[model samples]
Target: MAVSALVHLVTGGLVVGGALLIVLGWETIVQPVLGLFLIFLAAELRPRFGKVDEERLLRRAGVPRLFALLDDIAEAVGTRGFDAVRLTQDFAISAVPFGLRRRRLDIGLALWETLTPQQRIACPARARGHFAAGDVRHNLMVRTALPP
Candidate 1:
C-alpha cells in the first residue's frame, strides 16, 4: 500500500510539474497548446475520492427485522451501523464508506435467497469485519491512487 501510494504521488507530481513547466516556458507557437494538453493529462491522473451514491443502483432495505439484525451485527463487530442497507438483483454482498463517517451496505436479492439465515448474517458481518479491520480504507487508498 505504501509503495503504491508513493508511486501515485510521484507520478502525479511529475505530471503536474511538467504541465507547469510547459505553461511557464517562454511564449512559442506550440507552447500554449502543449501546455493545455499537459494540464488535462495531469487532471486525469489525479485521484478523486467521493461518497458512493445509494439511490441509483439499489433500493434501501426497509424491512425492520433486517435492520435490527444489521444493527446487532454492527454492535457485535464494534463499528457504527451502516448508513444505508440496499437490496439488489445481483449475487454479492458489499459495503462501502461514504462521506465523513458514514458507510453503506448492499445485499443482492439473489445472494440473500441462496443463503441460510446464518449465512445471511455472516455475509454482512464479514463485510463489516473488513471495515473494522481497516481493510476498506486501505483498499480505497490503493484504488484512488491507481484509478483504473
Candidate 2:
C-alpha cells in the first residue's frame, strides 16, 4: 500500500511538473513530448473495474442451470459462492472479490465451450484455488502498483 501511494505521488508530481513546463512554453520539443508521455503513464498506472453492465452479467434467472452447476462446484470446493457472474470472450476464468462478501466470477466462453465436461469443472475450481492460494499478483495493493 505504501509503495502504491509513493508511486502514485511520484507519478502525479511528474505529470504536474511536465504540464507546468509545457504551460511555461519550453524552448524545446522534448518538454511537450515528455509531458504527453507522463500524462499517458498516469492514465495507465492503475486498472479500474467499470460500472456494472447488466447485458454482460449473467443473472440466476437467466441461467439457472449454469448457476446450479456452479453451486455444486462451490459446495464440493468448500467456497462460500459467487455473487456476480460475467461472461467474456477471452479464454480465461477468474474470480475477484468485491465489497467484502461479494465475489465476481468472470467466465470466458471460448475456453469453456471447448473444454470437456470434466475439464470445465476443473477450470473454475483451479481459478478459485488460485485466489485461495494467496498469490501476490492477486493482491489489490500490488495490482494498483502495477502499470496497466
Candidate 3:
C-alpha cells in the first residue's frame, strides 16, 4: 500500500511539473520567440515589398551633378547631334557587344532604375568607338529604355 501511494504521489508530481513547464514556457519563451521571428521576417522582406520612386532617388543622389555628368559625357563623346539629353533615375547601365564578332563596345541602359554609382562610373570606361558615333549610340540605347 505504501509503495502504491508513493508511486501515485510521484506520478502526480510529474504531471504538475509538466503543466507548470508548459505554462511558463509559453509565457516566457515560445510567444516572444515567435513574435521576434515575425519581426525579423518582415524586415528581411521589406525591400522587395517596398516601392521606390525615381525622383526620390535623384534627390538623394544629387540631381544637378547627375545631369551635368550626363551632359559632359555626351559632349566628350561628341554625340551632341543626338536628341537632347534628359536626366532620369530610370534604368541601369551595362556594357554589351553589338557586332557580329562581339568585338564592338555598346553600353546598355537596362530596363530598370538608374545607374548605381559604381555602374555609372565604370560604364564609360568600358566603352570604345568613334567618340561621336559611340555617344549617339549610347544615348539612343538609353532613350529606348525610357517609357514612351
Model number with the top TM-score? 1
lDDT of 3 by residue, 5-46 (tens): 454454455555555555555757765555555445434422
Per-model TM-score, in order, reads: 0.75, 0.59, 0.24
Candidate 3 is scored at a TM of 0.24
| lDDT, each prediction | 0.73, 0.73, 0.40
For model 2, what is the error of residue 41's alpha carbon versus the real structure, in angstroms, after optimal superposition?
Answer: 9.2
Residue 104 of model 2 has an lDDT of 71
How large is the C-alpha RMSD of every model relative to the true structure? 3.1, 5.0, 22.6
Q: Is candidate 1 or candidate 3 better by lDDT?
A: 1
Residues 1-148, candidate 2, lDDT per residue (tens digit)?
6777787687788778768767875788888888888777767763443346667788778889888887777777777567678989989888865443456789899988999989988887777775667766556655556654
Using TM-score as the measure, name the better of candidate 1 and candidate 3.
1
- Go through the candidates in order and give the clash count of each: 0, 0, 2
The residue-by-residue lDDT of candidate 1 on 1-148, one tens digit each, is 8866786776677676667767676577476567677667767776656446545533235566767888899999988677777677889998866554557787888988999989988999998998889783536666566564
